[model samples]
Structure formats: structure tokens, C-alpha cells
Target chain A: MAMIDSTRRSFVTRIGGGAGAMALLTVVPHPASAETIDLPERESAILEAAFGSSVLTPGKISLDMPILAETGLSVPVTFKVDSPMTEADHVTRIMGFAPGNPEPVLADYQIGPRAGLAEVSTRIRLARTGFVYAAAKLSDGTLWGTKFSIIVTLGACVEDIFDLDWQRDAERRAMRAEARAAAAAE
Target chain B: MATIRISIPETAAKDEIVEIRTLISHPMDNGYNVDARGQRIPRHILHTFIVTYNGVEVFHANLHPAQSTNPYMVFHTVAVETGTLEFTWLDDDGSVFSDTRTITVQ
Candidate 1:
């Protein structure tokens, strides 16, 4: 897969830790470099109830998928479904769901007129081989869904990038407090 | 009243891509926290937040108390225009608190 390396490499975001939810990934992501992609039938049924079943066809949506991968913990994914984005055609929300994972709905993002680009990239984990689905909710109250897969090569999992426990945290906080005190009198 | 602080870095590009972060102060209660009576606190949450640009709603949410205490939300939206970012946070009781500040877009 010539496009595989360039694709997976772009998914990393420098958006550092901010919430407790970040640590919940321990049970969710699989090994590093090896990934298996799949999707459940119930997921499509849910969207069919919302968007009337025509949403999964890759009609106007511009999406990139990886044919092969080595990691399941932090895989890069981006999705952009075409829309006029006018009040009549704007996308009200874009939701991602990996049903096999601990959290079914990964994240729901709201988009508005000021949102310049239709493109979105983020790091996600695949527990095993499963389908990852993307859904777009339009302003008109309609739903759409698309499915994609990433083939795994290495099939080995890796440790999480962070544990976020109080032990490691206490050490970091102590150093920061020391620095703040020094700066206060300067 | 509990309130969340929102901050956007100065180095962030105007029209590139940026993650908007918001953290609201709330006991969240989760209906899981019990009172002296051993009764669930009845799930008090600041549900339904609206992010606006120039008086237009850009993003909104219907949040549940199950969301962690002092809920922190971050999402991506590309900036196409320069204007004040207005956030209206609503509570379970229909109470509304709003804040607005102009983004110094270069």
C-alpha cells in the first residue's frame, strides 16, 4: 500500500491531554501497527432508521481509507462528505461510531458556516478487525452513513501513550508548582 | 453559578483548522451521587450549549449529567471568517448564561 504510510502518519494531533476521558482508551484500542477493520449490521440499521438507507453510498463524500495498517491503537482517519453547507444544505453534525469498541460513538462534532473546511482528521483506535462508520446529519434533519476498513499487517498491540494516573501526574505537577513559585517573585 | 473557561491560542491560524475547547464548572451530580437521604440527586446537568459566530449558532449540544463533572468538550471547526465567538450554556432548568469575546484574527 503506497498510500498507506502517508495516510496513517497524518492522523496524529498535537492536542495534548485535557480531560479524564482520554485515559479510557486502555480497553478500546488494539496493538500498534497492526489493525483489523470491520463494522456491525446493527450500526447500519441505526442509520437507516435515521437517514433512510441511501446515506452509505459514497456519492458526494470524499473519503480516504487505508488498505493496510500495522497499528490499531492510533490510526489516522479523515472524512469529508460534500455539501453546499448553505442553511439549506449545511451539515449540522458529523458523528463517528465504532460499535465494537467500548464507546460506540467516538465523538460528535458540530459544524457551522464559519467552518472553512469540510475535512477532518483525528487519531482513533480499532480494538480488532472491524468496520468504522461515519455519519453526517444535515440541517434538514436527515442522516447518512459510510463504512470503511483498514487491513492489519503486524497484528501486534502497543502500550497506551499515557496512563494519566496520579503517580506520574504527581511528579509532573510538583515540578510545575516549583516553576510557578520561582516565577512569582521574579 | 458555575462557569467554564474557553481559551484560543494566539498562534492558531485563522482559517486553518483548530480545536475549540470548553470546560464548564458543574457538580454534574450524575444522579449517581447520593444525598443524606440516600436518594439520587436527580441528574442536574447544564445540557444544550450553543456556540455562535456573529450572532449565528455554529454548534450546539444536548449534554447529560453522565458526562464527567465540570464537563470538558473539544471539537474541530475551520474558521472562515473573523468575528466574536459567543457561547451560551444552558442548564437543566432552562437557565441561560452566555459569554462573548472578539477573536483577534489576523
Candidate 2:
């Protein structure tokens, strides 16, 4: 009992002494390890809307993304789909999606017969550290894709640019709106 | 406003795959930040890119706000003959920037 009491007291003291640590928590409290790797709801919906009744297989795509991106401002990504650029069999389009961004669909590329190539490389910004997906549409109406995760240190999608004052104001506005709605309901 | 640059092999063997690279200059505003006076800055970016080889459509892309300033792209294609490659980038402001290069296939 004494040992447990001592441990609890020490934990409290540690928590109280480290406001800087608390600030860090305000950003991403959950470490990357704690964050499960799963397809986000938005991403799943996008895929469903795109493929409709067709099946989306997970192969024939190569996604090149950095494991760790220091800046969310610009991260390079390259996508390649294995296809013969012939008349009957060719890649029609390649689309990029980021589930965590303010907008999920990042970019779309239309591959025509003249391109003769099925690979594309571009730089994209990220809102937060999250998974990036690339999907390729074939002429035969088949869809193939691949996804990879990236860690961003500095975020780019700044709805309020991390201003605490602005955040407080926004929160207050939201609360007032909620209260008004509840009163109206009553 | 933006300028485009493209790189391709000067010569290639028939049916050989050639790499194409391109770059553009522009500020891709994410439309989320406020200016110095705390006013939100409007977003601007190059939204579309299209590549044509010898009057045939080959590669095209639609960009978004997530793209950084001075966008760069690299792609691959097979060489068939000596032809002109036209690269065009459309801006959000309805402006178009274009460049052309010739690839000689031996």
C-alpha cells in the first residue's frame, strides 16, 4: 500500500512539473505506435464511390512516399501502375487520396494513349501524419491501388494556424450555437 | 503565374521506355492561413497538367491545394518516333503555361 501511494504521488508531481510536456500532448497525444493502421472512413467512402460495384484489388501499384516527412508543406510521392500502354489495355487514370487532409482527394491524372507511360511523380502537402493512397483505373474497368503511411512533424492545413486565441473563440462560437439549437428544441 | 520545364531523352531506341520530367513555379496556397492583418488569404495554385505527344493525348493530372509551391512531376513512356511533346499547366485563375520538347527515336 505504501509503495502504491508513493508511485501515485510521484506521478502527480511529474505531471504537475511538466507543462511543456502537456503542450506536446496538445498536438498529437497519441504516438504513431498507438495510432492503428486502418483505412479511414473518408477513404473507404471515396473508394466505394469510385469503384461502385467493381472490385478494387490490392496489387499492380507502386507507391513511393517518405517514411518521415519533416514538413507537411511538401512531400514527394511517386505512383506506378503495371500496364501495357496498348490500345486494348492501358491505365486510364491515377488518383491520390489523403484521408487526414481537409480535402481527401489530392490529385488525379488521366493517362491517355499518347503517354505510353504508367508512372507519375509529384509533390504533395499533408494536413497531418497519415496514410496516402493511390488508385489506378484501367481501361477494362478494373481498379488497383496501394497505400503507405507518412509521419509529418509540422502540419500544413492550418484552418486557424495553431492560434490558441482563435481556437478559443471558435470553441465559444460553437458552444453558443449548440446552446441556441438546444433552446430552440426545448 | 508559372513557368514549366520538361526533360526527355534526345534520342531513344524504338519501343524503349523513356522518362519524362517536368517542373513548374507557383505558390500553392492552402486557403487556410490568415495574412499579417489576420485576414484569410485566398488560395491559388496550378490545378491541371496535360501532356500531348504528336497530337496524341498521353498524360494528364489534376492538382489540388495540397501541392506545394513550384510543383514537379516525373513520368515514363515508350518512344515511337521523332515527335513534339506539348506540356501544359492550367492555373486556378484560368491561365495556361506550356512547354514543348522533341524526342527523336532511332
Candidate 3:
């Protein structure tokens, strides 16, 4: 009975030590890698530049877009923030980002107290199927945001053709100019 | 020359919220496409848009290449007194396009 009790005690100690090591492993690398792994570096940098150290709480902003877009050339996006629109408390700025686009920044809007509503609708181009994010900054220095995933069938900004010779471009331009001049003379 | 269009109600009540829609014609070339001859097309896009109401800036937008061609935007503002709303678009090539509309507030 004494030997059995000692074995049980030793096993419990080993299990506790193993659990502690596992917890340490998870805790040590989590915060450093989580942010980098969650978002692309460019997007994270842009958001950091815009919002500073403020945390982007995921609420109070409603971003609406089609779940599946027929094409990435023009996707209609609309966003509204729950704000009083008063001078003291209003949405000061709103920014949109498309992760898959060559240039991630879609648009940045600056709103003033005179804006009766904190809402905007615009068309944006997407390079491929990816996540679209919208973030809003309030007068109180807090930031709120939301993201929507969109599937694009036809992509944009990825055209492949071979007519990039500078000499050819200049010649084409001159020909067009001469044509225009001729038309003007006529 | 770009075609600029502004749509706003001619009149509104005091403190009434009115929607303002604006559209501009431009090829917001994102500088990513190569021509048929394999030449990259230079980027040319309208980078900024601003709306000034009653001599005060109310709404402004910073656009990028991700904005579609013929950028169209709709936003809301309060109608306070009678004033002119000036819409301006600033292009990457340093061209500025502007249009103005007057709104009467009762």
C-alpha cells in the first residue's frame, strides 16, 4: 500500500509539471505571434498608423457588402456607425481596407459635427476574394470596427498584356495627337 | 476634363438630414495593369474628395487605387440655414475638379 501511494504521488507531480510546461509554452509565444499571424503586416501597419494605440473594438460599426461579388472591379460598400452625431460625441473618421488588393486602403472618410449621419456608401475595387474591413474613430478617441468576407468571381488589377514598349507608347500618343489636330483643322 | 455630378435636395427644413450624392468620371488606374505590349500603365487616380458646406468643411474622403472607376459616393449632412455645398476632387496629377450646389433651409 505504501509503494502504491508513492507511485501515485510521483505520477501526480509529473502530470502537474507537464501541464505547467505546456501552459508556459502557449503563453510565451501567443501575444507576439497572434497579432502578426492574424493580419497581414501591411494592413496591421496601416491600422496602427491610423488608430495609434487604441484598440479596435468590434462593434458599433455596421459594414455591409455583398457576400459574393460577381466581379472585383466594383463592389458597393456601405458603412454606418451608431453615433449620436452631436458635436461632443460623433464619429470623426472612418477608413476601409481591402486585404487582397494591391493597395489595401480603399477609402478614408473624415466626418465633422455637421454630418447629421455617420454613414457612407461608395464603390471599391477588389483585387481578389478577401476580407474587407471598416473602422471608425469616435470623438472620444475610441475606435470601433468590423470586417466582412467577400468572394469575388472576377478579379481586378491583374491585367496581363504585352504592349509596354515606351517607344510604341510615344508613337501611339503622337499618332493620336496628329489625328486630333487633323480633326480640329477640318 | 472630368464630368462632375452633384445631387442634393434644393431645399430642406431646419436641422433636417439630407443625403448628398456625387459622382465623378475618371479612370482610377491602380498602376497594376500591364498593357497589351506588356507595359505597365501609370497610376492616375483622384486621391481626395472634400465637401464644404456653408464655408465649413463637413465631409472629406481620401481615395486610393482600390476605388473603382468613376468614383461614386453618397453621404449625409445636416441642412443648417441657406448655404452652398462645394464638392471638390483632387487628382493625383494635381488636377482639381469642383462643383457647387445651393440648398435652402427653412
Candidate 4:
């Protein structure tokens, strides 16, 4: 009985290896691990959560960003979706996600057929050096996306006050003062 | 109530893609910060931004609390004809701020 059990185990191992190799050849589910777009595992997971069961294709998105950001406080980004804004077809919404930030979702925009064009430009804060993913949902339930990596020289969103420099600390204080002044003015 | 400022070129050639910039004066209170007494601050932020040209929507954004105090946004739109470009910002307190600029096509 022991000898027969050993033989069955070996047979099953051989068959499993063959099927695994075949499955790898046909499967490309996770582009996050691809060679060109080496998206971090956490970011990939965030993307999956942001758009569940929806396959994100790298198209229809024109992402304008820099390769290096001097500071993580404010980085300008522009995203445009190439779509025919007709009554029949148009972009319904666009969303920006930052995996490294405390809040994975940075921004969400809703558009409609009334929108003659689909585009947005704004500055976003990055917690660290990472990639930004922008996805656009079409009227037909299709989601298109694009991503870009940015290297941050000075990181933002550091909670520990002791970790910040004099200049940065001063800046934070000034920003707070400005916010208060604005509130008072209103 | 809030005040808004918009910047758009006064003139552009036909089919020209013109840039639009908007700035609003409001503290985007994220509600994450605590006061001196350690009481949590309630979040009050601009919820949406919309731009319309010639009575048609062109761009829109649903802002989040992470945005800065005074929100600034810049976008682009094709100058197909001469018309009014309107910018509207909606706040959490059921207030809306709007500004407009006219564009001429050469």
C-alpha cells in the first residue's frame, strides 16, 4: 500500500507541473507585475479594490506628470480621456488613486454626456516616491487607465513632528495661520 | 459663501485649445485635525467643481478632503466658438460660488 501511494503522488505531481506551465502561458491577469510597469503590490491591490472585477486597459488616458517631484507637497498632474462626447457614448467618471497615501483615493470626478470634453488638472500630495493611477469609466461600463511613476525628493504627510525640519515646520505653521485667516475673513 | 477667481484667455484661434485656471478662497477643513482642547474638527470642503462653455459642460471634479485649503484647478478646453465659460464650485454647506469669462475666437 505504501509503494502504491508513492507512485500516485509522483503521477499527480507531474500532471500538475504540466498544467501550471500551460496556465502561465495563457494567463496575464496581473499587469502590475509586468516588466514594463512594475507597480508595487500594495498599489495593485488598491487598484483591484477601486475597480472590482473590472479589467483596466492602458488606453484612452493621457497622463501628464513628471518623472521626478522636488517635493511631495504639491505635484501637478493632468489627465485627459480621449472620447467622443456624443449622446451615445462618453466618459462618465474619472478617478485618481494614490496607493502610498493614507487615503488610497485622491480624487473622484463625475462627468456626463453634457460634458463636451473629459479632462482635469490639479495638484496632488504624495506621501512617498510611488506611482499614480488614473482610471476613467465610460458610459458602456468599460474602465480605461494609465499610470506614471514619480520620485519624491522630500516626502510629505509625515506625522511625527520631530521628523520635520525647521523650514518644513515653519511652512506648516504658516499654512495653518493662513487657513485660520481665511476662515476669519469668510 | 466663498469668492472665486477665473483666468481664461480673452481670444483664441479656431480649434485652439485654451487653458482655464480657477481659484477659490475657502479653507477645505478636512476634519482630521484636533483643536487646542483636542476636540475633532468637523469636515467642511468643496464637494464639486464644474465648468460649462456655451451652455455645455466641459469638465467636472468631485473634490475630496485631502485637497488644500484654497483649491486651485487648471484645465483645458477647445475654443470652438465665442461664448461664456462658467466656473461653479459647490460647498458642503449648500452654498455655490460661480464666476464666468468670455472668450472670442479669431
Candidate 5:
């Protein structure tokens, strides 16, 4: 009985190895041939939450930012949307997101016909080297989006200072000041 | 009160597109950093900024911690009439800092 069991186990192992090799052979040829732009899962989820069920058309948005940043503490960004800025047709909102940051949602701008141009410039903090996305919601309920890739030499948002007690330090300074005042009075 | 700087044309033509720039001084602590003793620093940042032209809301922004220190913004608006433009910045501590500028549209 033991000998028959060992034989069956070996047979199953051989079949499994053969199937795995066949699967690898089939998948190794295609190295992502399609040129479709893919967004990270978190970024896609954010877009879905902002504009539910609306198709994100990748056009009409021009995102301008630096390709390389010396520091992640501040990265300048500018985005513009091609719109007439009329009462009937205009951009209603623009949103910026930094997926590499601790909190992805950077800022959201609300505008209307009063906004003569759908352009904005601001500074944002990035945690690391990654893609920054900008989306615009027009009056017609259509969503337009774009993205820019940036590389950061020094990242931000990581706690740098440690082993320093702010409260105790302040207290000690205050005590020293009081002692000085007492000596001056005497 | 925080220091604020606003730059806009003193006068503009009717229906002209005018660029408005604003800068405010704030720490914008993102709460992710730690103190000298390794204690987490509480987050304090300017959360909202709003601009009203002649008492009508023109542009507003919801800011997050990702905004850099001393937030600066530049945007555009149509000069509909001669009126005051009020810019307000709201802080995380429920404090509001505001400034107003007058523009003449001929």
C-alpha cells in the first residue's frame, strides 16, 4: 500500500510541474504590448469617487510640472483646461492628486463662469517619485484628465527629527530665564 | 493673523481676463513629522481658501496637507464690474484670515 501511495505522489508532482512550465511558456511572449495608459489602483479609485460612473477622457487638460525635483517638500504645478469659459460651457472644478504622498488628495479648486480661464498654479508636496494627476470637471458633467511623472531626489513627509523633547526644552529655557530675572532683581 | 499678499491689476477692461495671485504665510504642518523627542507633531494647515468678487463667490479651493508651506496660488477671473475682491483663508484651528482688494473695471 505504501509503495503505491509513493508512486501516485510522484506522478502528481510531475504533472503539476509540466502544467506550470506550459503556463509560463504561454505568458512569456507578451510583454505588455498594448500602449494603454494605466493608472494605479488607488488613483483609479480616487477618480471613481470624484466622478462616479463618468468616463475620464484623456484630453483638453495640460499639466505642467517639473520632471525632476530636488526636494519633495515643494513642487510647482500648473494645469489648464481648454474651455470657452462661458456661462453655458466652462470648467466647474479642477482637482490635483499626488499618489506618492501620504495623503493622495492634494487640492480641489471650484470655479464657474466667473473664472475667465480654467488655469491654476500652485505648489504641492510629494512623498516620493511618482505620477501626479489632474482632472477637470466641466459644466456638461464630462471629466477630462492628465498626468505627469516626476522624480524626487529627496522625499518629504518622513519624520526626520527625533530624540528632542520640545516641551521639556521649553520648560528648561523658561526656568533659566526666571533664574536670570531673579538675579537681576537682587 | 497671518501675512497675506495679493497681486491683481488695479484696473481692467470690461470682460477682460485678469490674473489674481495670492500668498499666505503658514506652517502647513502635515502631521506626519515627528518632534525632537520622536513625538508626532499635530497637523495644522490651512484647509480652505475662498475668493469672492463683489460679494459673489468666484473661486474657492479646498486645501490639504499636501500643500506646501506658505501656500501660494494663481488663478484667473473675469472683470465683470468695479468691486472688491475678498480673499479668505481658513485654518485648521478654526481661525479665519482675510484680505480685500479693490479693482476698477471700465
Candidate 6:
């Protein structure tokens, strides 16, 4: 987690009143013990009730986050996996989890042979330090994943009563990414 | 707590990959903020997540405390034979919350 400075607040206020609040839809499921986040344990129960016991293995996933975020409200994030994409070796799903939250369930991506490769990258918010895991389903009808811990000291999405700009920053970031990629290829 | 919802496009053509978007509500405590007592609270978080289609587990990510509460993640998947896509959430207590979305792959 990172701390907020007065300048950042003013920056957000000047922009608008929409801090990627809608973006909350894509979460990374983490554990409560990883940070001060208190979440109901039933989230997983809900998961099991819907999907039966699917085997999840270890050492086949990766999470890219900061050891110490410069700001808690917005952190750069990227997730990737090394799985075969053939019809026989293709992956079916990809899930992201962060432990220390009121609800640990994050974003879930349904992937297949069309995903190009077993790779994905996006921005996410971090509230604390704990283990982050990536779980994937292989064409063999089995589950596999990987996990890592990040230590920090601040909340990422919080702000003053009338603060915004997370969305703008995200948009700016997307453009910059595109520009940089084009520059790199050039 | 916020309800996490997941949905797959019903228009997904058979064998066409569709994008999945999911959101869960949880407070990500980075062990930085202090309460009225100024006590450094302990860590609590989601361990890992697993998504499956028909009966096969597919995608997943390991979450850390540093991730913001109610973290929202987006990923991609393919609709092979037109079946329900089951999305599940796994917690530290070994608990799980899941939902199934029907995919009408043309």
C-alpha cells in the first residue's frame, strides 16, 4: 500500500469524480491473512458450490506487482502464464486473486486458442501485502497455478470526498503503452 | 462487501474466444493504515482463484495483500462447444463463491 500526498488529491479533484470506481469489477482474489483486509470466507464456498473440485497445481503461473507501490490507489500490474495453446494443450480460464479485501474474488478471464498466447497484462489496485496467485485450466481437464507475496503499507483506491482521475490516468496509460509499443517496433 | 459478477458473451461463435470480466468486493489492507487505536492490524486476504468451463478448470491468478480491495481482473477464454462457463472464487478459509454463465456459441 502507498500513501497519498496533498498534490495527488488536488490532481484528482481537478480532473473529475470518477476514479476507476467502475473498474472495481476486475479484482485479484487474495487471502485475508495476507494483510489487514477482512473478507468473508464464504466467497470460496460460493465458488465450490458452482464448480466442483477441479485440480489446481502449483509453479505454473506468475504475478507481476510492486514490492512497494509508489501510490496505493493505482498500481501497475501484469499477469502471464506459460501454457500450450494447441487444441490439445490449450488453456480454458485464467483467474486473479488478492487476499486482503472485503471480498477476495477478483477478475476472471476465459481464454482459449484465440488468446494468441497464454499471456495478459493490465492495471490493478493493491491495498496490502500478501500472496497473489494465478490459476489456469489446461485442455487436459486439470487446473494449475502460481502465487507470490507483495509487502506494502497503504491502500490504493481511497481518496478524499470529491477526488477522481484514476480513470484518466488509466486512459493516459493505455495510450502511452500503445505509443511505446509502436515506438519499440519502429 | 460487493457482489462479484461474471458474464460471457452469448454471441460467441463456436470455438471463438470470448472475454470474461469479473469483480469481487474486498478491502485490500497493505498493513499501512492504522485504526483509531493506532494498531497495526494483521493480514487477511484471498489465496488463489480457479475458473473452469463445463467441468474443466481453466484460468487463475495468485492475489497478494498489496492488491486493492475488491480487485477486478479481466481475462480471455474460448467457447469450444457451447456450454456453461463456471467461474469460482477460492478464499483463505478454503471457501469458494462461484457463478455459471451460459454461452450460446453460434
Cα lDDT tens digits for candidate 4, A1-186: 111232454465466753442111111122545423334566557556655633577677656555567776666666678888666898887887777665656677776655456766677767678777777788887877777667777654544223335467557767878888899999
Q: Evaluate every candidate with DockQ and list the scores.
A: 0.12, 0.38, 0.36, 0.17, 0.35, 0.10
Q: Residue A103 CA error for candidate 3 (Å)?
A: 1.0
Residue A15 in candidate 4, Cα distance off native in Å: 53
**Which has the greatest DockQ?**
2
Candidate 1, residues A1-186, lDDT tens digits: the string is 112332333332113222222211111222334332234666556555545652443333333445444565445555565676655577766666665443354445677645644444444445445666777776776655555555544322211122224366456656866887799979
Q: After superposing the true interface residues, what Cα RMSD does each candidate give?
A: 9.6, 8.1, 10.1, 9.9, 10.6, 8.9
Per-residue accuracy of model 6 over B1-106 as CA lDDT, tens digit each: 3477774587777767566767776665544444553344455556565677778766656665545567666666667767777767766656676778887777
lDDT of each: 0.53, 0.72, 0.79, 0.68, 0.78, 0.56
Local accuracy of candidate 1 as per-residue lDDT tens digits, B5-63: 88554444566555566677776544433355333357676667788878777676655
Least accurate 10 contiguous residues by lDDT in model 1 chain A: A18-27
The per-residue C-alpha lDDT of model 3 at residue A58 equals: 71
Q: Tens-digit lDDT track for model 3 on A44-127?
A: 789789878435677777666666777788987777788999989999999888888767998899997799989888988887
Each prediction's RMSD to truth:
13.9, 13.8, 16.3, 16.5, 17.6, 18.7
Estimate, for each residue in A66-101, the C-alpha lDDT of model 6 and write its tens digit: 545555465555555667687778766666666554
Report the alpha-carbon TM-score of model 6 versus the true structure. Answer: 0.47
User: Which has the higher DockQ value, candidate number 2 or candidate number 5?
Assistant: 2
Query: iRMS of candidate 1, one decimal?
Result: 9.6
| Candidate 3 CAPRI classification by DockQ | acceptable
Ranking by DockQ: 2, 3, 5, 4, 1, 6
Per prediction, fnat is 0.18, 0.78, 0.94, 0.39, 0.93, 0.20
Q: Fnat for model 2?
A: 0.78
TM-score winner between candidates 1 and 3: 3
Superior candidate under TM-score, 4 versus 5: 5
Over B1-106, each residue of candidate 3 has an lDDT whose tens digit, in order, gives 9998888999999999998988999999888876774456899999999999978999999999989999999899999989899999999999999999999998
